[model samples]
Every structure is written in C-alpha cells, then in structure tokens.
Target: MERWKKRNWGWKFADHLSELYVVALLLGVAGASFAAALPLASRWYPPQYQGLAMGIAGAGNSGTVLTTLFANRIAQHYGDWHIVFGLALIPVLVTFILFSILAKDSLNQPAPQKFIHYMNVLKQRDAWLFCIFYSVTFGGFVGMSSYLTIFFNAQYGLDPVRAADFTTICVIAGSFFRPVGGWLADKFGGIRMLIMLYSVVAIMMALLSSLPSLTIATSLLFVAMMSLGMGNGSVFQLVPQRFQKEIGVVTGIVGAAGGLGGYFLPKILGNIKLATGSFTFGFLILSGIAILCMLLITIVQRQWRRTWIGASGKARAEHV
Candidate 1:
C-alpha cells in the first residue's frame, strides 16, 4: 500500500487522508517491531550483559540522525521527496529477508505467555515503576528529538538548517552514549546509574527553563540528551531483571507508555507556550516530573536491591 502510494500512477488515489492512514499503519508495525526486539535481546544475552545487548539494539535510534540529515537532500535531488520513501522500501525489504533468514529463537526460551499472564504482570508494582522510568527517559529523548529544532529556531533565533545541525549534534551524542550507559549499568548498576541520570536531566531541564545564553543552553541540551539516552539504557537494564519471565509483555507496555510520553511532551510544550507565552513552564514541569521519577526510583531501589540485584550476584560473577 505504501509502495503503491509512492508510485506515480497511484498518486491520484493517494490523497492526504490515505497517506496519513498508511503512515499510521507503518508506525504500528514499527512499534511492534521495537517491542519484540527488546525481549529478544534479553533472551539472547546473559543477565549481566543484557544491558549491553539492549543498548546496542536501542542504538538503532541513530537512524533518526541519518534520515533527518539526508531525507530532505534526497527529496530535493530527486525532485519528489516521496521518492526517498520508495527508496527506503528497498532497504526495508532487504532487512526483512535478512532478519527472517538469520534470526533464531533462544534455546532456553520460556513457555509462551498467555494474555491473562500479561494482565497479571501489569498488576505488579515494579512493572508500573519501570514503565514510568522508561516513560521519562525514552520519552524525554524522543520528545526532545522531535521538538529541539523548533525550539532552537523559535527560542534562539537560529535558522532552520542551523537548528537542525544543532539537533543532530545532540542526537548523535545521545545515540552514541547509549551503549556506554548500558556498559556502565553492567559495571555499576542500572538503578544507581538511573538515579544519577535523572538528577542530571532534572538539573539540565531546570537550567534550560531559565532560557540561558545560546551556547550555555545548547550545551545543557546536549548534556541532557546524553543523560536521557543513558537513562533509557539504564532502565532497560533493569527491566529484564524485574520481569525476567514476562519481559516481552512488560517491554510492550513500557514502550507504549514511553511513546505516549513523547506524544504528550510536544502537546505540553505547545499548550504551555500558548498559555504562558514561553516554553519555560513546560521545561519546569518536565523537570519536576524527572525529579518525581527519581524519588519513585529511590523508594523502589531498596526492595529491588534486596530481591533482584542481590539474587543476581552469581550471574554478575559469571560475567566477570
């Protein structure tokens, strides 16, 4: 359907509504693919190295940088930017074939979970904790990626191209640090790493809310993005541990919450801008939420240390 929409002959039938509907369908598939991949990584890797594995998988986000940087150039060069979409289909098809042929289920896979199992999983307090943590971390990263360019243009008076360049820098920093964050979580601990990451994010957001000078603000954003990226890695490091038996469903639910957080962030920024005539309030509110998440993490860290982390000492020793 998407391929047809991109073809010249089918362009006549591909109105705006049809294009949007196709996009919605594509996004659904993309979300499901991400949710599935999380559990696969957890299953394939040992407990201690799960964070590193998940971090590598999550780093696929770097594709955002490639598309943002090149999509426009491809469109301008081709005289029909939608041609890029058509070209993208080739890679998608190739990857699909490659994945189908090469991917294998883990030998130690758990029994397939039922829908009721997922409902019961959702009832667990830790599931909701992980969801909120991911919602803020992944949510903040994606939300900033979506809005940073606009913020630069509107707040700092940067031209569109320069704004995009700045955004790219922040995104690259964030994407590249994800695996490092995971490795650190493996060495240090996911919860401890996240507490620090959240504190840094909260501080950076607070500074950004003050609308500092361009250089300072850009630096803050870059640091915040990097921290948020790490926070994302750190959260996933703990997810598989907390929901070892139900990682798949918990991943899907937490991932969905993260997406919802991303969606709400832009709305919050836009609404706050309209209501109070600046983005300061929105940033402050987000900062507050980060702090709140930190407090929640602090509250739960004790039980987690006793139950999960303490029990996993043998696994960590094996990795060593």
Candidate 2:
C-alpha cells in the first residue's frame, strides 16, 4: 500500500506541472537543498576532511550537465517540453528512495543556537566576507552554466543542440573539478588555492571579453568555469574552519548570496548586450570582481592565520 502511494505521487507530481512558472518555483525549492548539504557534511567529517566532504556533496551541481545535455533534445524529439519534466521524475524518485535507505544522521550535531545568536552571526565581518566570496565563485559558475547556451547561440550562430553541447562540456569541467579543489585545499590550503583560482578566472574572463573565435571562447569559458567550481570548494573549506558551530546558518546565508549573484549575472550580461551591442563590458566587470577578491584574500590571510587556521591556512591541530 505504501509503495503504491509513492508511485502514484511520483506520476502525478511530474505529470501535473504544466506551467513554466510552476517549474521555476519547483526548481528554486529544489536548489535550496544545496544549503543543507554542506552542514551535514561538516558534521559527519573531521575538520581536515571538511573541504573534500563538502566538495563531494556539492558536486551534485553537476546535475545541470544532465539537463543541458538531454532536456532540449528530449523536448525536440517529443515536440513537448512537459514530457521532459515527466521523465525527470525517474531520477528524482530513485534519489529519494536511495537517500531514505542509505542516509544517516551524524551523532556530533551541534546544539541549536537562538535567533539572536544567528542575528549576531550576521554582524561578524567574516560571515559577510564568506558570503561575498561565494557570491563570486559559485555565482560565476552557475551564472555561466545558465547563460552559456544562449551566448553560444547568439554569438556563434550555433543551433540549440550544438550550443547546449558546448555548455555541457563547460559545465562538466566545473562540476567534476569541485572535488579536486577541495582535495587540493586539504593538501595545501583553501586560501592559497582560491587565490590561484581567482587569478585564473580573472585572466580567462578578460580574454573572453575580447569576443574571440568559437574555439577560443569555449576554451576560455571551460577554464573559467573550472576555476569558479574549484573556488566554490575552496570557500566552503574555509567556512567550516572559521565558523564550525554556526555552519548551518552561515551556509544558508552564503548560499543565498551565491544564488542572487547567479540570478544577476545573466541579467547584467543581457542588459549590457542590449545597451552596448557587445558582452565586453559584462565580462570585464566580472574579471574586475575576481581581481578584487584575490586582493581581499591576500590582505585577510594574515589576520586569518593568526586568529583561526594556521599560517598555511590548514586547520590547526587542536581545531581538527
């Protein structure tokens, strides 16, 4: 009887969302799951493994690759976008069942803090800094993921299928490299890794602003997305170290800022294109933000080493 009910809900849930606005609402709700993931990962893993644990979980963003690669083709083939939503229920149901069976709660869960405590957390400078850093890194990664297909279609005259293929290749790099970023941060230091990653993004975005050839543009975007993905991992690596007890609230705030950044980036680019007849200013502005973040990190690392993580940005032995 329980199994039958689950199947019935799944079928109706996917089949009934006929409106695009409803789909967008559902997607927003689903995306909020990312905020829950890192805190759970931090609770389950030791400080030394925080980055890797969060990165592995965060790599779920790669689900975007599946959508980019298949959704359009599926819609075109069926001549109806609604069927794509219905087919999506298969993976959603599978994940739900697997999580229900396999997931475990960590024993070291922290006591819940009061509302005032959370509000005070917002007063801390570090929390805002993390929010800003994530806004740029995760923001750039998702923004580009959402917009690249359109950019390719408009700029290079590629058909929807070909443009989506290009976007998938870029998204794949960002999605998979997230874990690598965390591993590197664990081995070296999150701060150091992010510094290098931001430099890469700054350079790549600047080059891309030139409106290079199709091959050159794709190569640049691939590199930029990889850096942004890694930067996302690196930022989270530092967050738990700096605010272990407040991980849940802090992660939610930072994650929301990243989402806002993602929302604005495409709008900025689109508006720039309309106003100036080119994407040059938008890319240049993004590049400038990267440079600013790099400089900010360099200045802050000195104080950070003294106050929290060691000189190398690794979690202190006692903290771990």
Candidate 3:
C-alpha cells in the first residue's frame, strides 16, 4: 500500500479513463456471486422454510446500514475516502474464507441439467410475473436506499450527514422487516401477503406525492420501506414454490430484473424533477405501477391457487 502511494499508483488508478470498465467488470462478478446464494438457499431449506431462510440471508443487505452509518465518518477520520475501500477488503476476505469453510451443499441438490435448459424458464409466464414482482419489491427497496439521502436533502433541507441519518433509519426499517416478512409469509400466504403489501405501498406512495411535512414524510417513508422489504420476502417465498426445479436460473434472471428496476427508479425520479421541478410525478408513477402489480397478481391468483396452493391456502412444505 505504501509502495503504491509512493509510486502515485492510486492517482493513476483513479484517473485512468479505463477504470470504469474495470469497475463494471468487477461489479458484474460481485453480482453473480451474490445471486448464486439464492439458489443455494433454496436447496438448503425446505419449501416451508424458504421465506425465513432467504429473508435471513437477504438481511445481509443491512450491510447498507454499515456503509451509510460509517462511510463518511471513516473518510473524515482518515482524511481519504478511498482508504475505506482498502479497509473494506479485510471483511470481504474474512467472509469469503468463512463461507468457504462453513457452507455445505444440500444432499438433495437439484440434478445437473444441460446449460441451455436453464434458459427455458423464459418460456414460462410465471417466470416473467415473478421477475416483474421482484423488480418492484427488491428494486424499489434498493432504489429508495440509493436515493433517500438526495430526497431528504432536497425536500427537507437536511445536510448530507442528517440526510444519511434519515436514510439509514429507512434502510434499517426495511432490512429488519425482511425476515419478519418471510416469517409472516411462512405462517400466512406469500401471495396474500404481497397483495396486501402492494396495496399499502400504492396508497402510501400516492399520499407521499402530496409533499407532506418532514415528520409525516419520514413516517410515510419508514412504513413504505417496511412494506417493500416484506414484499421482497413474499416474492421470493413464491419463486421457489413455483420454480423448484429451475430455482437457480430463475433466481439469477429475477435478480437481474430487480437490478434493472433499481437502476430505472432513480432515473425516473431525476427525470421528473428535471421536467416538472418536483418529484411528485415520480411518486405518482410508482403508485400507479404498484396498483398495476396488484392487479397482475390478482389476475394470476386463481391459477396460482389451483396449481400451487394447498388445501391450507399456503405453499406445501414439499415442492409439487
């Protein structure tokens, strides 16, 4: 590290035009690694435990809390934000070693199929539905996580630190509820839970478009995050149920849909702000989409019940 600093290598890396390409490559690798966990989680846990298991695993998203809570402080303390990136390598390395040692494949792992066969999931209507559903839930959670600080600063006149504080509060609310969502879905029904959640999210977003007071906005956002978080759990709970055999491939595809959704949300907000000088349109647009998602799910309800739901109105503990 000292040698690189002495050689001015850090500046070289930071200034090089091609660094964006390198960063993008590395990000893709990281994304693949993260998505791999979903399929493994399906194999390790039975159908009934899918929600709780995935929720607990997904709670790793709370890593956002750590970054939000400390990134600025670390930069201030060290006088170089880049140094925190170096420090982060320590935890990443440690986690990799622990995962390699502790993680085990399930005995009943899905049999290997031809590589091209995984692509066949594209033929299924349910696959697209799940992808869109996840795109809304996980995508909205991530999008909000990315934009809340900006939103707070713009709407409430908060400084960056205070904005981050508020953002962290929302992030934590969402993260904490992820497992709770899954557990509730396990006890209740994932689809039913999601219908209720999406309806609430639509209502909240519509109300938020009115540009309420700071206190009211914060409360509304907190509830909104909680609902989205739980929606995420519910979506995954149904995925494994519907695509037990193709869980791995479906997870990768759906996860990518979620990423695309997250990418678009901030852009939509930015566009609305630019065109209309207010973010009200963005919230209204999201509210309309939420309503559309509810209707889509409702349309599929009868088919899902006949095909997947058991006599208990819940997913069977075993895959059909």
Best by lDDT: 2
User: What's the TM-score of every candidate structure?
Assistant: 0.90, 0.93, 0.92
**Candidate 3 lDDT by residue in tens digits, 127-179:** 99988998999899989988888999998899877888889888898888999
Clash number for every model? 0, 0, 0
lDDT of 1 by residue, 77-168 (tens): 77775576777678678989999998887887799877897789877888888889888988888888888888988998987667778888
User: What TM-score does structure 2 among the candidates reach?
Assistant: 0.93
Please identify which of the two predictions, 1 or 2, would achieve the higher TM-score against the true structure: 2
Which 10 consecutive positions of candidate 2 have the poorest summed lDDT?
8-17
Ranking by lDDT: 2, 3, 1
Worst 10 residues of 3 by lDDT: 7-16
Off by over 4 Å in 2: 1-19
Top candidate, metric TM-score:
2
Q: Model 1, residue 305: what's the lDDT? A: 68
Q: Could you give candidate 2's per-residue lDDT for residues 120-200 as a string of tens digits?
A: 889899999999999999999899999999999999999999999999999999999999998888889999999999999
Candidate 1 residue-wise lDDT at 306: 70
Collision pairs in model 2 = none
| Candidate rank order under TM-score | 2, 3, 1
